[model samples]
Target: MPGYGYVSEEQRGVVLLSDDAVIPQVINDRLVTAFASVTITNANVTGQEILPIHTADSQGPRGDESGWIQVVSARATCSEGIQIKIVLPVHFSIKLAPGQTYPVPLNLSIEGDNAPKSMRIHLDLADLGNTKRWTVSTGEYELERREWGSAYKITFLDYDHSVHYAMAFPPEGNCEQWPEKRCPVVLALHGAGVEASSSYWTESYRRQKNAWVLFPTGRTPWGYDWHGPSFWNIESALDALRLRPGVPDDLVNSVGVNRERLIYAGHSNGGQGAWWLLSHYPDRALAGLPAAGYVKIQFYIPYFMRIGDAYADPLLRGILESAISEHDIDLYASNMAGIPILARTGGSDDNVPPVHSRRLIRMVNEWSRKTTAANLSEIPNQGHWFAGVVDDDVMQSFVDTSLQNASTQGLSLPALPSAFSLSTLNPASSGSKGGIRILQLQVPFRLGTIRVHRQNDQWILNTTNVRRFGFVADDRQEGLQRWSVDGTNFDKPPVVSGKSYLKGEDGIWKVADDMLWISEERHFSTYGPAIHIFDQPFIIVIPSTITERTITYRKMAQHLATSWYLFGRGGTQIVRDVDVLDGIAAQYNMLVLGGPEDNMFTKKRQPGLESMVKFLPGGGFQIDKRVYVDQGTGILFLAPSPTRTRMGLFIAGTDADGLLRAAWTVPFRTGLQVPDYIVLGEEYGDPSTGWTAGDGAPFGGAGTKGAGGVLAAGYWSNHWDFDARCGYLK
Candidate 1:
């Protein structure tokens, strides 16, 4: 149910449209800011406030304002003959003859006095101010690998418009170790009810380095987001997994698993989504593996489906009908002819009948011998429940694809050296996304001690040292803060702890071993007066020790060259300064490291960025404060600003509260436009909120060898702060 407004008894004859007022928007799925209050004059007595409530939860206080909210009921108010004005997120414009105060029908229900529960009400612009804003978290997931000493690297691919996804690389790195590089990946899908953001399942899959998995959410035409569908959005999402800042460019393109070396899989709604994506995107995989899913679309009928037939289900049926009522079945059939499909279904599956999948497969194979060759596997005793019998075979085989089928379905990582420990964290990504792990502590190894591992293909930072962590403000960079790891000298022996704990190594999320400190000064300016006072920005620079360094960097250049051609995902134009993952993204395209001045252009990123102008078209790495990069190669687009009507009407011009960017002037919505130049080094504090660094603000990392302050060249940072890490090994 949607959230509506609260009414008070004192204003019986008057309507209160402010303060926690839940004015529902008229447009489907469109949200409106909530209002604070609305007053009505010449009203009756009785001053009482009523809030949103649910009559089904329990009794006595049925009409009490204690409950959260129930947006469906228009007659929820207490008074029977009271008149009130309700504000809506949508404004109704009337076009009468000329000068007329046309009475608009408002959906305010009062038993008999014209207080209709559902009417389109006429409202003024001033009656709005109560938009509900809730907190949403896109929690982080740790990458995993089974092998030791492996530079953790993994590529991810997701498709939601056609299928739901949630995948991760093994806990280990995917890059070339002293002996090897280039890791394998897995295709993971989600079930019904949960989105890709859910850590419960994603973490489970994130613990493997041998394979990488992909995750995506479903979308509905009538709903605000997605329900399930694949290829439609999968292409772009896969592109993002490869294009995200900080990944090794060379390794990014390698993530698109060898078509012949992949396994297709899914669960529940995603189960059907998987089948659809496989049938739709012929080049997506080598084998099909869906659990708790139907054998065909026929099984999706309500009487048998667990979620019931979405086509028959009130909510999804409407969505399904509206979304594909005009689509052609041949489109899906033609796409399925080239690939080998392996359908895994539960005999008793209810959400999706085993029969639906069975029928769909039969239908596809009916007309073509090549398509009919596809295989279908069913679990004997399994049903609609999520647990299945093939997790090991499917996952393990995906990891060992090269070894198992080295010829037709093999993908090998660069040869890696045997397990080895780092000499120091300074040169490794252990301290940041761009570097590697730190040195291993000597002696006094603690038992049951904990270690923290990073997400994606990052190394672990050893925290066994006696060093204490703290955040320090650069008297130089006014608001920026950087973490320092100190206390135990290189000569001190390691301390002892209770149990062995691995933050990213053992599991997706492990407990923190030691206390972490952060100072209020997190965001810093590049050339700000605050940092200037400290003499200069003093950041601990890590060594460039990535394997296949030149090869990797070159690959990065290539990835950048063709990034725009890559389909899927949102935003375009390169404009953020970030770390270069030598072997990863560098392998896919050429990456250019523009100077640090990219962080200051919060309003207009396109101005004065000569490097972006040169690098974008040249297909090289360019960095700046702009939101997107690689428009020349792929669709990493910077989403456009919100519609003008939704602009914040604040007295101050710099309110810059809109999500994504602070710029009020937006490029009118146009077809996906690609630019020949690049700029995107200045990273936003949060993508949802367009927080950027001030002009001339430093990137806040290690500067060139001799440069004293933070502004020196060679120092790098995507955002405003530095991350200090502590962890345990063995």
Candidate 2:
């Protein structure tokens, strides 16, 4: 075998290590590594030339290195045509032109050890040659190039890290020189299965002229209607994009985006999200276009068929219903009466019924007889996707007309039409855009409503389920010189402090920064035992004693970090209990991983743990004098952090077996059945197999004998006070 040769298997092609790789915005040159394996057919292979080809004919060499691609390294091996590998590391020095997709196709040239430069032979391996391609892009303008968008891992201090991807398209024309010219912004949301970073879902909007389109990953691949923490993820992505490099400064400045012309649009799940965002934060968007979106989760996905709906207890049902009500878009449809909305649904869609959209329109029209009815358009025989529905001229006309109308209305909140009603859940003061000056809520995802009317020189506010609320007013507004509140307990005349009017003596006009607000960052903090340990920035604390179970927990932590990085990109640090510095507890939530016997931190916090669940001396766990001892138990609960008023989640097992069980249950896959607080028993299943209720809880007397042995799965009060009424026990 004198000549160089490469082999290709019939069934497989050259392995492309980085498939659909995204290039994030970077100020300096970046190294991109791609791997492939080339098997030697019969000859000894020495070196290989990896060439990068541009897919587009329009992309030619500029005068400089801007269009040139340099291969930094190409290391290869030769074997029995069976197994050989190569590493191709390329250094991309040129800045990719902003708002363009560069698909780089790779080609390889193989050479024998003694072959002359003139005798080099290029073989297109069936596996590697023409099959591998990489899409590289720069800047966050538009959703046309998905590979250019990188998944960002946002870490919340004392909370978990969230992974989200976002892309921003540049505005048309040269706006940088003319800083006064502002562009309209469209916040686009993706459907359920679509990744936030996928370009396919955002490609249609690229056709819109002179507009800046933002596609946010919405935290998880399948987020829950973009509520709670997911809502914050959208905000965080917007903030990051505003400061990101390569974005034109004029396009991001105060004058760059016509905030008054902001439009929200989504398809399927994102359609539902558009409705959710519009109704909850009515003043944020000037108009909304929700295409093929379901009204609520219960209506979108049947809850009657779900496992949780089988419960018969009135208290349990009430608690579950209350939680579900937070996401019911129809319940808040009345809030959309004043906002300009154009909802669409496919006539032949099977995923989400079209009636949901019709029902929403009807509700909004009925709620506000004074305002014009929100429009609805049905595309005959169209499916759930936005492709056919959004492409319709009617839909495009609606969007353009809405944007033009909003531009004339200016950037402030439009005056509420007569006899208007608004509802909100976890309303933040920051989201108040239009200066409607009605009410702001403090609680997270707690429904609150206000019916307001202006008469002469006073504004009357009829409120419901609003414990902590405030009103904002501009000195320039004429009729609403005074506000009269009806629902809340604040009966006395409001005291004027600064620009806000505080209700009664105890009411503070400032935003309420409490446990409820903190819970929004991490839902498990609100009512725990079932806390999301991975969502917040947390430190795992290990005790001095190193038992077999301790080692298991350490490995579990490593596995969790690896898995999290595999899914997105972020990891938490683990430290010894003794190594924890003095204020560390205040900065990060602690995940104590051992039992009270071995973990000193857990031992020190035993006094506080006694109030929630007590460990019996004879051998079992005790909650309110109910003892469970037969099976080894694992306990998980959330309490006030010993260092501060923040939250701390403690996971400890009765012994080595219990600790091991708790480790496997921390991840959501196997922990979905484990609620706020759980006492796991000896019975267990493979972690690969989903959760089984029998494997956890009610091992002894704590749970009902006939019922699934869930010992304790309920939430504590907002103040960390023990309340039997707040949660349901087995």
Candidate 3:
């Protein structure tokens, strides 16, 4: 009773610590503010005290935390930095030393003669009767909004679809000196739950001299976790800011966002998003600052949470999880070996532990040991959220250093390491490093490493799990010389510009011709589980003619659309088959909801897709001479688009019920894997109640073909053909 207080029947809480402190007398100044450090004793008696200053999810409290406490105070109204925006809370179990006092830094502000002279403050630690209030008096650092730059909105069409983002010019005002003089740009990404509509992103960052800040909503707060479509968001925003099609030339030139001097900075999930771009598109950023970022899905949670994994076969599980494995940040660290990275984290942060930052920095240094491109900044006595985390002097120095490195004319791409290895899991999402790139892998869902060493007379290269690799011809003092790859020697290889070489099925490396390079392979860009289709702009094609199953088709389409918005923040366009024709829709990936008989688009492409699987007149489909006529069977697979270049996803079933079951496999988030082809049955039971699939067991399964309710599941071969070794059929 003494420790806790009751605000209401449902709101029972406790104020761990409270104290009254006098502010510096507003002597001869109109406004005053100071940094006060209050030392408090850890008197929890039970264990270490937790200061949960912020929550990651926009939804609700996770784990053991609860809603924010309703306290009437001016301190609560202040959203000065990332630290005090009170939302859902998560208690990080970080243990501080026993019987020790900790310093809790507080920023106090006062204005005008009428402002409150002194105020009381509360914290998580126990109250100390005798304590000194350490204060550092200084001028009021807060400035007028105009000095911080003006935040404005800009819209652009991404592949004919409308998209908008927030942009701000520097304190020097708009780039009035466009082509004559340009300014740098900072692409600031917001954390999870921080809506793009808020002014926080634009105003939160410290204004850089002659630099513009662009904030793309990333569709929604959690769009692709800032991966897939988020890339397009940033590019479109930059394009609109620098040069737009319809906008007046004066406004366009007013903000010259230099492409060569681009910098990326974010916090929390956004911090992870920064890492994603830093690793995947290293050439795009001059430098990156990721504060409180997590490593990857598996590292975030050791035990898999997907119910399917408990019931999936070992091989099937591998195929499914491989789809997620592409997003693993650690595997792609080699690409960031050349970029300057300053990773920041709270020294005592347990929410997204500091280890994530440490692990990534370690990997980056290991790949670029000579340069040591990445460094870590761990602020002591801080949690997940802290004031001045991204705007600190050290961070400003890193960014300023990167800006100084930019050239006037064009981008200054990092020089290729004389001898460095390039590692990649998905070549499509990964950019070229050290002038070397992997076009495709010998096997899908496996790590591919290409090691290069510069010897005296020639360059040596070795590859593991690599099918094809490419290199650019560059001018050096020694000029083009001999080359050796996988023990095959070549004297003056015929690569005037650049060339790609592939290892044929015979295990011999040969120069890849224009027609045989990356065209006919199941690259990660073209072939993947259910989630891969949303990597780009996709249209949902539903049936034109109305029938008893028409509502079901529409409902399924709507469900897919809503899921994308909720999970990936995707703006998926849904169109009726009759309204849009093949010629116009061919440019976009099509997500056909119903079977060929009901959906005209599917019917038109049935013959083309027959090479792998054939859809029958009714709901039954044929795979490799086997016909599954089960009324409850649902089939979801990937097929070549009408253009024979893009991808088309088919989510169909033998009947209405089966269609609903198939939609269950659409992975909106991580931890769930769906192979290139997956068959769902009624064995999953009703979704409203819960999952009863695999007889309600989630540990281990029998086999791929008949395990759980999965009738069949497997990945397509490099040529997009049925591979006996990679697939299972009933």
Q: Report lDDT (CA) for all predictions.
A: 0.28, 0.50, 0.61
User: Model 2 — which ten-residue stretch has the worst lDDT?
Assistant: 27-36
- lDDT (Cα, tens digit) per residue for candidate 3, span 257-339: 57545687888888888898887766566789999988986777774655545665677666656767777888888778767
Cα displacement (angstroms), candidate 1, residue 137, comes to: 15
In order, how many clashes per candidate? 207, 19, 2
Residue-by-residue lDDT tens digits, candidate 1, 149-217: 222222222221111122234324443321133333355566655645455655544344444465644
- On TM-score, the stronger of 2 and 3 is 3
Candidate 3 lowest-lDDT run of ten:
126-135
Which pairs of residues collide in model 3?
175-254, 310-698
Per-model TM-score on C-alpha atoms:
0.31, 0.66, 0.71
lDDT of 2 by residue, 1-730 (tens): 1121333323121222233322232211211111111111111112121111222111233222122221112322233231222232222211111111122222222333221111111123211122222221111211121122232221111114322346565554432322245666677888876876555665656545555677776655665456644555667656544443344234345325544346788888888888887776676666788888888876766655544334334455544345346467887776776777888998888988789889888887787674356888888887777465644677778766765564454443444666667675434312332244333332333456777775665666776654444444433244445556663333243332323332433543333433343432322233333434433456666665655454456454445444443432333444556655546665666677665666677777778778677766643567665665654566666665665434566777666556655666654321133444555555442223224433334434322221133345555544454457545554
What is candidate 1's CA lDDT for residue 614?
Answer: 22
Q: Tell me the deviation in Å of residue 727 in model 2.
A: 1.7
